[model samples]
Target: MQNYKKDFPIFKNNPSLIFLDSTSSTQKPEYVIEWICDYLSQSYSNIHRGLYDIAINSEKMYFDSKQKVADFLGTHDLKEIIYTYNSNYALNIISQTLRLNKVLKTGDKVLVSIVEHHSNIVPWLILKEEIGIELEFVRVTQDFDIDFDDFEKKYDEKVKVIAFTHVSNVTGKIFDVERIGKLKRPDTLFIIDASQSFPHMKLDVPKMNCDFLFFTAHKVMADSWLGVIWGKRELLEKYKPIFSGWWAINEVKKECFKPGALPFKFEPGTPNISGALSLLKALEYIEKIGWYETVESIEKELIEYSLEQFRSRPYLQLIGNTESKKRVWVFWFYIQGVHALDIADAMAENNICIRAGHHCTEPFMNYLKLSSSARMSLYIYNSKDDIDAFFKILDTNFNPTWLTK
Candidate 1:
């Protein structure tokens, strides 16, 4: 674990500062940063628009990034991986495109779980109201896991899409997407918000049996403001883009403005060529360092250890501890006598940064009857010492009001 910490620059540089907010965004490693710098400084050029050699190289790099993302997600069809600004944009694209194509219709229903982040929830809600599509949330079990039995019970022919999170950002509860997809009627499409899982666990969209999946590079220790969306090629072909940009047709000026085929149709702007290459480097770093080894090691040292540290605390309320095999090492908890914001601030003062809020899933918080919670999320770069430091600070129960002095 000490050797693993060297790969992430932030930990090596700021070893004293315990960072537990990986659910929000992870710190980029030196390699990811250097990769972006090298691309922008040495090979900087507009892709597909410039006639220079740099432009040709840039275009290839951008396209290769797409291929890398496809291979990372276990898909061979490079055209299925669409570049977007972020995971939120990717989800919106999926929702808007499906709604526009009438795949989501007036009488049709879309099923989502109660544990979804706002990113997963809001787009569908907007479409449900706009198209008069019925939107429903499947109930979660007491441990905050997807209620598979209830999901099966609620599922029916009227449901056209089942969009849910692969892992809950707040609860760290992992959804068995393969099992969830199997419960859906054959006609229904399965969409997975893989933001939480992609960074922490081994995932393949095909193995998960999802029709669509979204994840951001920043969350996965890659470049900022870049994300990947994977969908079935046929669905990408059939779906219309609601948020079209001029760059969508950069390659097809000779084609009289026909939408660029497959991925480009979804990626409608000057793509983040540098960011994409940086993401590739980050992906390579993850692979070379051994993703499964890192994931399991982090789970053992940070996630499981953190959960154990909090288990006996009487004032804390921990969510998402299930016997199911699907859970990743993420966990959310709230202090009994302390406000989540206050607790987070207290931790922050001690150089322990964790996240405290509704986590953009206001509806889920509302369902859980909590406006917010103090979330301690873990990733490969995190260690058991970070968890110990967090718990040590949390044990102090310092009131935020005292900081005013």
Candidate 2:
């Protein structure tokens, strides 16, 4: 695994550094950076603009990267994939598509869990206000898993869609997509925010039984600010792009213009050629390293070991279930005599960076009765020693002021 660490240039000189905030973003690998540089330097040209050699070659590279993403996601139809600025943009696109198709309306309701990131929850709120649809929330257990019995009770015909995170960014709880998939109705669409899970865990949308899904490329060690949205062909076909640009149309006729079909209809402007190229290289990097095996080893060695260290600590409270199978490495916890922000700052002083805040799940924080918590999320580059050093810092610090606050 240490040999694999060599591929990530960010970890090379920063051997003493600890990075545990992969939920926010991840460090890029050397190959992805090189791939982007090569594209911008050598193959730089606008795609689908001209038949000239460079333009044609650039178009090939851009579309080829899309095909690579499709393959990585295990989709049969390349047209089913749509590129967006980020996961948030992708979710907005879906919400717009749903509105345009009238799949969302005054009487319709959209179901989401209480633990959703803002990317998943905010869009639904906007839709509810704009289109007059109702928003419904599923409950979570004390240990942070979905209350399935409550979810089943909330299931009904008025619910037009159900969207949830595959894994919580703060609690690191992994949702059983299979269970949610089983609740699909004819009119109900199932969407999964795979931002945290797709990068680390093995993913198969068809197997997960989702109707629409999106995840960012950079989170998975791919290109920055690029993401992929996967949707069933039929549902997307019914949507007219809300922000349609000239590029989204098939042709500008002598009289007027007409929109392209399916995926092309959603891509509304000049594409990110360099980012797409880098994403391809990142997917290739994951393939070479073996995605499944990497995830498995990290869970066993780092995630489980870290949990074992604090599981029995009286002054510390783990926010989610420690069972490796039910969680990812994106875990959060609190110490009795510590402010989350202070702990994070102390860790940063030692060159260890973790995240501390509501983590964009303010509603969940309210539910937990916690103002904030410190999160130590893991990626492939993190080692057991990193976890060891972080815990050592926690043990060495005890601030009485934290408890009084």
Candidate 3:
């Protein structure tokens, strides 16, 4: 019931805007924006190479942010974290580096679930095409939850790697990562895509037992173009740099060069300095606002309220788990005989933003026999009023007559 929208400037500017698409990207808070602007205007400089006052300060801030990221993820080792362009680039780094270093070879198997985003699937598919590695997809149940029986059956000694998402972007089902982590073979590496879950939950890398994990900053109220990759030191040191340049080199002769240390070897060239600062501020803001106690409680309340509202409307067919406690704030549903795009356009006309598409999981969509669905993802800034407004639009604008047609 608390009003958290005042922290976001977008709501003040667009009074009628009801944003329900935080899963795609979250709106920036005033705290993060002001910090980014102040840093850029007063002390902006390229990091790691300059020796002047501003340069030294900038380099310190950059590395301090990396350290903050490591601490936030429950890890103390700074060398384990690598900043990249985004989650897509991070996954590609892992795949390509493993392939080039011969860590992943032909005839090996990689296991993934059917409810993964393209970012997690495409790199492995390309690897399958390039090498002789086999790609297998675990099935999902009718309710959109992971079929753990099938997963256990498919997982074997041949599977050298297991890559999966912590939460499904389309279905909002929280995967049992701890269970899977315990089931993994000692020699097989486990990777996690936390882009969807990081914003809504508390994540500890050691507790999850993943060899590698990555997520984007934009989804957590930070600026875009920054992603974080955390891996075990030993595994990261085993693979050579997939892309090497000025900052990632240790020593350079005329013909060959040695790669630098853990993170620098992976993060080549000039990185996103301002964006990294923004992430530091964003994490600070979340902590200051009591992320676990306050932000998570608000999201849970919104989810329960939204599900209660959905129960009153028989026309709206909800997808995924119906129980509120089993999922996050993402919800996907459709009205029978109504095209998803048309529903989205109708909501847009009412100044309510929602997404209707495959949501980058075309294979899962194909499996469900659904081309598209309307998705409403909430965040800390949302409230029960937003849910009421969304249902109001559906009730008054879309009637039984229209639904039947």
Candidate 4:
């Protein structure tokens, strides 16, 4: 397997650190970090507000970053991409805008799944309370996959919106978004949260048939506090932005105002210029490594190796599909009679970093009858050696008798 750890400086600084929580956030690459520093030091200015050389350059770089995001999502329309704080902010904007636009009225239904993160679920719940809309959830099968039968049965003309995650943050199971997107009615809107999938796979927005998709930059090795929301041109034009400011408007009177065009309308303030530039550099880093040809293969091999090690340790019970091919490298597991916090603290003491919590999916945890679980999510920098070391720690530290006792 390729050793991509050299690209990230964190591993070099902490020689014994074994980071296995990339699903939550990835460590920054040297390339992205340097670019951010250089851009801020050399050409830092507010964009679209000035015509000076540095200002023009900064504005160009910001839009260029947006264009790069558009290209990454396989969309030709740059105007369709809007910048926000994160996926959570993006979802809130969509829900509020749809409600304000009358696209979602009282008694309308929104279909989501039990596998969604709190970011996707809470917005709809709030909308339900505010607008009297009905919120429904599609169940998960025993294998930790979405129940398509339940989805189809619950979906009908009254279901005005369908929102789901492309990959479950806890299970790493990739949903069949194309199938669900294609199955929806013409008038129904489809929204996808690609926080876990965008960094690992190539997604074609037009081909997915979804009206809107959103993801955060931090998960893809970029800076945090930046996100992208890509929507269909017509849909974006139809919905008025819930938030407005000086840059987001064309004209304003004391009583009313006209919102600006596609992206600017939704983006209402001094944006995260450095965050966007960092995302551009992160995408470039992915391209440099040949994401589809190299990174994906490396992650697959790591998943297989990790699963093999997991199987040998019978005390560890995985929460999702046992097959590596069916999921990403994220694994959530538990030991009988051992608390998740105890396992995570033990791993931390051994210089291994893994996450332990409900993983922002309390509903899914409730569905599985689990209070919490320990998660180890792999990324490009992880290797078989790391997995072996992890298992070695487990073998030396945890035993069935101690766990049961």
Candidate 5:
């Protein structure tokens, strides 16, 4: 529909290739790529490290990028955002210190969802092992959305923290964060991993009411992700930096001690300046294209058509949300007698790129009795022709007998 493929250099570089793995990482737009190259070539310097104009200019651009990203998310408080290497790093920073706070003591409970990515689940598991905190998971329904009843059963005063994905990577089902956030106990903290949702929708922290949220840049069409972590300003101000570094210094006097302010307290080293700046450019591209509604409209139609086709194919088992309204363009499915890995290899020969794996959500896969499935994730650039080409290859030459035999 929108057809922005011309804006990405990758398609031009490989004209015959069809890429449908936007959930893992999006192809970069020309503007974002150019911005990164320009900064590296013309103005590369360590930020906040020198008095010279070159360094000052670098620092200005770096901080301004932060402000732009903050404004993009409908906040003016630059203090709320911290830059890190990726979503895993950002969430790890939170997991490292959040439990040590008075609120989440040993034996306190935490809740997660069955659809959570490994990055969201592993940190809590580590906290459980290291500190004796208890962990629980909300179930996924037969239709593939979060089971709110199960969520309510798992949530209570004993649960000191709750974390989940706003949009699942494998299913692309958008969760009602507002509904879940409201269910949180009075003192219980809520965290959201918006890695998939951030690329497809608009998010404002005040609206979400989450204590902390994180998303990776690469998934949003910015190459070489560093992540963005947003927290409630007051909460961040009181939280201690989990790691120590020279940049986290707040006082230098003898016998004087205090951690740095909001973002600086959390971001404790030389930052991902270029990646952050490129993410800002990616945001600009999204804004220029239009709001999430139009993007969602295109995706909903694509997903409807896709689900209809998958349902008609006797040999295929479609997974994820059954209704279009509950899902975005992401889909997962496995064909009978076809190994997911073998399917992916055959698709590669047909000049198509798709992902096949448990996708790091192995527990969820286990629940479905699926060892692996092929994933197709879409973007605004994808069109009906792309789907036709994808399905055509699958129907005709998916797994040659030589490989299958």
Candidate 6:
């Protein structure tokens, strides 16, 4: 498999750094970095609320980027796209908007999967606390797959929303979202958290038939603190403005607020113009690199090879689905008698980066009866050598499993 290692500039600058924590955030490619620098240097101004050349150019760039995002995602509607600080912020806005607008009422139940990231869980928990909405969880099976039976059992007439992750960041198991979407009741709104899957797979909004989807740009090979909320236009229109400031103007007299159009109503305040442009570049970069199929094939080979080597390690214990077909390139496990942090520190000492601890999915960890674990997540840039280096770092009595060439 061809490894496009040179596409990322960080490798040229810091040649020894092996980035295995792509699940957390990926290294920016040369294209994205250059686009950011060029955009900031040439045109740096606030978007909209102004008519000067700089402002007009910035707003055009910003809106054009939104259109590009919608096009990239294969969505039919551009008006449904709303950008936020990150995925957590998007989910919080959806939950809050639903509540503040009284679309989701007290005593309504929302079903969430146990495998969700904390971003998916905490917002609903807050809703339950602040608005008296009941929270329900779909269970995870022994292999870390979402229990469809439990998910079905939790559904009822009172369940207004079904929130879930399309893929587990810790386990790398892809949820059967289309099948789950079929279980929605007449009034049930399906909210998908695609923070993990969006980067690695192809998604079609109408095909998925979800009311709302949440994903962050960082995890998809872009910069930080940028998120996307893809809501059905009708659902977005139902959103009540939480921050009533300069943008949320309805009445001229006392400034009693009515919501603005599709996106701006929810995304009030000054926008992250650079973040949006960079994300657009990231999408272009991914497309330029052959998108999901090419990346998926390469990473699958890397993980399969890595899993074989992992099976030989006596101290290392593999978590979730051991077979490569059931998961992505992410592997999480605990070594006997070695703290996850210690392993992480050792890896860091060897100039490799990996994630350790609950991974912001403590509920899933709790479900598995684990305090913590370490993760080595791969991406398009990762190679078999990176996995070999990680394994070599893990063992004190290192044996060469790699080709000298």
> Residue 351 lDDT in model 5?
87
Q: Kindly report which residue stretches of model 6 are placed more than 4 angstroms away from their true locations once superposed.
A: 248-252, 397-405
Better structure of 2 and 3 per lDDT: 3
- In candidate 2, what residue range of length 10 has the lowest lDDT sum? 396-405
Estimate the TM-score of every prediction: 0.92, 0.94, 0.97, 0.97, 0.94, 0.94
Local accuracy of candidate 1 as per-residue lDDT tens digits, 1-405: 543567777877876777778789988888888777877788899886888999998888888878888887888788998888898888888888887787888988889998888888788889877888888899998877778788877788888999998888877777778888666667999999999888877777777778999899998788788978899998888776776666665344554566667777877668787778888888888888876666666576555566667775655677777332457766787866677899888888888888888888888888878877888877777777777787777766642343245
lDDT (tens digit, per residue) of candidate 3 on 44-160: 999889989999998888888888889888887888999998899989989998899887899999999999999999999999999989989999887767788999899987898
Go through the candidates in order and give the C-alpha RMSD of each one to the true structure: 3.3, 2.5, 1.5, 1.5, 2.5, 3.0
Error of 2 at 111 (Å): 0.2
Mind giving the per-residue lDDT tens digits that candidate 4 earns over 180-287?
A: 978978989999999999988998998899999999999999999998999999989888789898889999999999899877999888999999999989999999
Global lDDT for candidate 4?
0.90
Residue-level lDDT of model 5, residues 247-297, one tens digit each, is: 777776676666776667777778878887898788888878776776777
* Tens-digit lDDT track of model 2 for 171-190: 88889987899878777899
Minimal lDDT window, size 10, model 1: 396-405
Judge candidate 2 at residue 67 and give its lDDT: 81
Q: Which candidate is the best by lDDT?
A: 4
lDDT of 5 at 318: 70
**TM-score of model 6 relative to the true fold?**
0.94
Candidate 4: minimum summed lDDT over ten consecutive residues — where?
Answer: 394-403
Backbone clashes, candidate 3: 0
**Candidate 1 positional error at 75, Å:** 1.0
lDDT of 6 by residue, 1-405 (tens): 888889999999999989999999888999999988987898789976788898898888788778877876678577888889899999998898888878789999999998889999999999888989999988988887878888878898889999998988988998888887777766889999999888888887777779999899998777888899988887677666666545545444564556566657667778788898888888888788888788888878988898898898756798877888767889988976667998899889989999999999998788788987999999888888888899888776322233222
Better candidate by lDDT, 4 or 6: 4
Alpha-carbon RMSD, candidate 5: 2.5
